[model samples]
Target: MDLLHTLTHRHTTKAYDTERKIPAPVVAQLLEALRYSPSSVNSQPWHFFVADNDAGKAQIAKATSSPFAFNASRVMDASHVIVLSARNTLPPEYLQTLSDQEEADGRYANADARAQAHKGRAGFVGLHEQAGDVPVWTQKQTYIAQGFLLLSAALLGVDATPMEGFDAAILSTELELAEKGLSPAVIVALGYHSDADFNARLPKSRLPEKSIFSHI
Candidate 1:
């Protein structure tokens, strides 16, 4: 399908059919899409926690309690839920790990090239750290991955909803993310829309191009 067609048809699904599940192969492809998502300085400082089973979904549902009750059913009813997280810090070891992986993947021509790559990435990461908001910078990169996942899901004809209404702190604790140096950034629910999902019937609305875009 054309990319424009996919974008036009996709909407933030409000209700999902609990009985409908994404096939394992398709889910794997979506995961790949996220894995290959672009990030600043190629830091790739994000982790994805996918819940496709009842027990896992139940754990995520807790994040929607009380103040976040509005999105509880969206979590419980979707075929799968993905918790997007950002690393708390860009540790030196991680940059070394990326450098090693890049060399192994034949991204550099020689030792000098590899060193240069590491130095450049380290410099960029150091700048962010010095700014004293590394977590926020890392979280911004996670959103880029989220955007890729959303577009990939749309192209696959899967209904998805990007949700930020849940409690992040509760979710991080429930998912034991802090142990992994991760913090919840956002959640995405993926599945087929329910028959009662009125949001699908509503006309898609957007500002006119002239109002939102300009070319110098």
Candidate 2:
């Protein structure tokens, strides 16, 4: 199927059938597709670690409040656990380039002028703050990548789920992601869906396109 139809056809498959293990090559292909996703200044501040082993899956599974209570069981049930992560610290060059471009836009003139007017003020809001917080930028990019991974997995004919209901600190410790300054953004369970999972899913919800999109 084409990208458009693939997107429409893909659903978050919660109950992966115990039918088949998702092949390693399939997961690799999904990552290859994700490589093409857009990123801030092309910094590509995200990393993905595909987990199929018991110990590795447990590390991610433990990064939750219940630490195996809810979704952890599903980890073992799926063909693979896909950890979508983002770096806490972005590349200095990415931030620098972004700041320069934003400053060039001249949105800060009034703010800068005020600070200049008052020597003691030191009152100027830097372009970074105006650009939105760093964490926000990183988080946004991660979600975008998450979308890519999900779509890529779907296109590969693999079922997947994007899950955010988990603990980052626990996951960081469990996955040794702290040294890398990375934290789990989401965990996607990939495999073929069980017949039960499909039967239990709620109908999809969406707003009309006219309401969500803008022509003006």
Candidate 3:
């Protein structure tokens, strides 16, 4: 599919068909896309929790209850719910882990190359820590991955709704993210649009390019 067509056609799906499910292979590809998503300094400080079954989705839906109850049905009805999380800290050990993986993957040309790679990435990570908000910085990187997932899902003809309306604290507790040193950043529900999804038939809307973009 053409990139423009996919972007133009994709909209925030408000309702989903509960019975439609994504194929396992397609789910795998979407996950691979997330795994390979680019991050600043290759920090890659994010984890994804996927709920593809009713029981799992119900657990996630619990976070959307009460004041956020409107989102509960969407979470429950979607074929899958993906909770994207950011690491609470970008410690030296995590950077070392990334460096080790890179070395194992032959990303370094030599010993010096490996050393330089670690130095550069570690320096960038230090800047975030020195700024005193590693969580915010790390959460920002997760949005980049979310963008990739949005576009990839469009290409795969999957309807997705990116949501930040739920209770983050509730989600964190429900997912036990604190135990993993992670916090919820965003949630995306994926599935087919329901026949009653009025938004799907509406023309996509956006501000004029002249007002929203600048050539300079």
lDDT of 1 by residue, 1-216 (tens): 999889888999999998899999999999999999999988999999999998999999999988889899999999999999999998999999999999889999999999998999999999988999899999999999999999999999899999999888889889999999999999999999998899999988999999999899
**Cα lDDT, model 1, residue 65:** 88
Clashing pairs in 1: none
Estimate, for each residue in 82-171, the C-alpha lDDT of model 3 and write its tens digit.
999999998888888999999999899999999999999888888878889899998999999999999999999999999998998888
Candidate 3 clashes between residue pairs 3 or more apart in a chain or in different chains: none
TM-score, model 2 to reference:
0.74
TM-score of 3: 0.98
209 in model 2: Cα distance from truth in Å?
2.2
Q: Provide the overall lDDT of each model, using Cα atoms, as 2-decimal numbers.
A: 0.93, 0.70, 0.92
| Candidate achieving the largest lDDT | 1
Q: Where's the lowest-lDDT run of ten residues in candidate 3?
A: 121-130
Relative to the unseen true structure, what is the C-alpha lDDT of residue 160 in candidate 1, on a scale of 0 to 100? 96
Q: Sort by lDDT, best first: what order? A: 1, 3, 2
Candidate 1 error regions (>4 Å): none
**RMSDs, each prediction?**
0.8, 8.1, 0.8
Looking at candidate 2, what is the lDDT of residue 77?
75
Clashes of 2: 1
